[model samples]
Target: MYRFLVPLACALSIAASATAAPRLVEPRLHIDKEHIGPARIALTFDACMGRVDMRILDVLLRERIPATIFVTARWLQHNRQAAATLLAHPDLFEIENHGAMHVPAVDYPTSIYGITAAGSPQAVAREVEGGAAAIVAAGAPQPRWFRGATARYTASSITEISRLGYKVAGYSINGDDGSLLGARAAEQRVAAARDGDVVIAHINQPSHAAGAGVAKGILALKKSGVHFVRLADTVAPHPTPVL
Candidate 1:
């Protein structure tokens, strides 16, 4: 019995050590230029919490540009009017899950960008599923994608999210550093986006200048004839992970 226990403990230690550490990755979508034809960009916004940034929405509405929005259950519950407005324009917006409580999808006791993580596989499931359920309850079609808060995840969490039958939405360009950037900085970053780029910005901070800049950058992209597409419409071949 003692010999068996020793081997079992050693195996457990080995397995634990093999688990990969959490990585901060910027996930990039592989756009097929031949199939897509011309420059195609996907603009994704995180409605994590707080009021909707009308500055950004208004531009999308006025210009008829389509965008994918990842919303948290908390955000949906708090911004009913904004949710309704988004739902009204099914042609321009596709809503996806951003987790239930706006927690990072890390299967350990850790934090990402100052936000607490899900901390366990079970908790991660709860966060993802809860957000999906909220979208359905709000009268939108079931979400096919999930973008965890902070856009950061543990390898195990990413696997778990995929196992749950949702594609993890990752961004190639960060238009706003969590809505912390000023207007000019955000505009510059967003306007510089290239073809096949997946741009991520925030739509939950109405007062933040980043939202205004995002609007301007999107207009600039439109002026340059850069076509916009939604994640649901294009095939995002395996995301390239950035360390």
Candidate 2:
């Protein structure tokens, strides 16, 4: 009995040590390097709630610009018509998970504008799965990307996201339309985007001038020979882990 107890204690210690070690995350979510390409940029938007500024979306669709939209469950429910519209235009937009309730985590400390990170692994999965269900119900193909609330994601969350068979998305550039600095500044920000850059913006709260500016910038860039690509197409495929 004593021998067995001693071995059990040692095993527990080893297991705890292994768990304490830092987890591995995808390079794209944290790394800041670009590969060879034709200067492609993925324009993304986060639609949280209500009737969004369709004007911005209209521009993307009419211009045939490809984009990825990280949407929440609440947003889809509140704006089903708009959600359906986006779903119909598959060439212009790809729907991705942005969390369920967008609840911030208390156990871990992370922030974007002083907001906490999303909840635990299980909680995060629920958020992601829930949004995926909503998308499917609303007639959109399931999302392959997961962007955490506030865009503040941790290493653990990244591991969970990968385990759930979704890519962790982090932008290389921010157009800052959500920051609301007028359309001109927003256009300038988007114009500054380079090759292999993933530009982030918001279309949920469209009362600001910057969102409009972001749309304008994309068109202007197109006129100057900049081509837009869907984030799914731009991202490196996640390699399946060997068991």
Candidate 3:
């Protein structure tokens, strides 16, 4: 009886640890030839789920700034209304896939991370294809780009995803708003922003403390004449083509 009880306890411990693991796992970003030559930067927003911020969308459209927004299935389900509003403004944003579930395991390697959302090429296709469908249903053009969950992915995953007809979107710089740093620190982070830098920030998490600072930094840079362009415009054009 005691031996059996010990085994059960061990199983419970493993389960608990697994549940506590993070959802994003390899954390790689890609910057190709065009970005290197032109000093062009791509500003990207991730809309995972929960808490929507229209202010970010408002600023982009009002300023005529174009960005790539990576959306998740959860976000599409929860913010269909807001999604419609964003799609209507094609001039300001291009919606792409963040992944179907935004699960951390989907982006990590097998041995390092115990979980993987799209462990196989087939699974990756579903997340990418399903996400595209969701955006189309919400009125946005199908996404030709795919940014893996948590920005973590393997070479094989990248190859498979690309083979399946999606270009993996990566970043050159990060705004670190997810850290929830205040506007001051946020300003400091973006102060280093330059041409050809792909900067990532979260627009879905409205309550993020750093959101205000991120906005300020962009505004300040714009005043200095930094032209903002969508990632698709600046990235290496995919063979399948996305207009």
Among these predictions, the greatest TM-score belongs to: 1
* lDDT value, residue 188 of candidate 1: 93
Best lDDT among the predictions, by candidate number: 1
Could you tell me which 10 consecutive residues in candidate 2 have the lowest summed lDDT?
24-33
Predicted structure 2, TM vs. truth: 0.77
Tens digits of per-residue lDDT, candidate 1, 1-243, equal 899999999999999889846565656564545554569989999999899999999999999999999999999999999999999999999999998999988889887778888899999999999999999999999999999888777777888999999988888889999999999999999999988889999999999989999999999999999999999888787666666
lDDT of 2 by residue, 108-196 (tens): 43444566554456776777778778777777787888776656555666677778888867776678735467888988888888776
Estimate the lDDT of model 2. 0.71
Q: What is the lDDT of residue 79 in candidate 2?
A: 86
Q: RMSDs, each prediction?
A: 4.7, 7.2, 7.8
**Could you tell me how far off, in angstroms, the CA of residue 95 lies in candidate 2 after the best superposition?**
1.1
Candidate 3 clashes between residue pairs 3 or more apart in a chain or in different chains: 23-104, 24-104, 27-152, 39-195, 39-196, 40-196, 105-116, 106-117
Q: Please report, in order, the local distance difference test score of every candidate based on alpha carbons.
A: 0.89, 0.71, 0.70
Q: Model 1: residues >4 Å from true position, as ranges?
A: 1-26
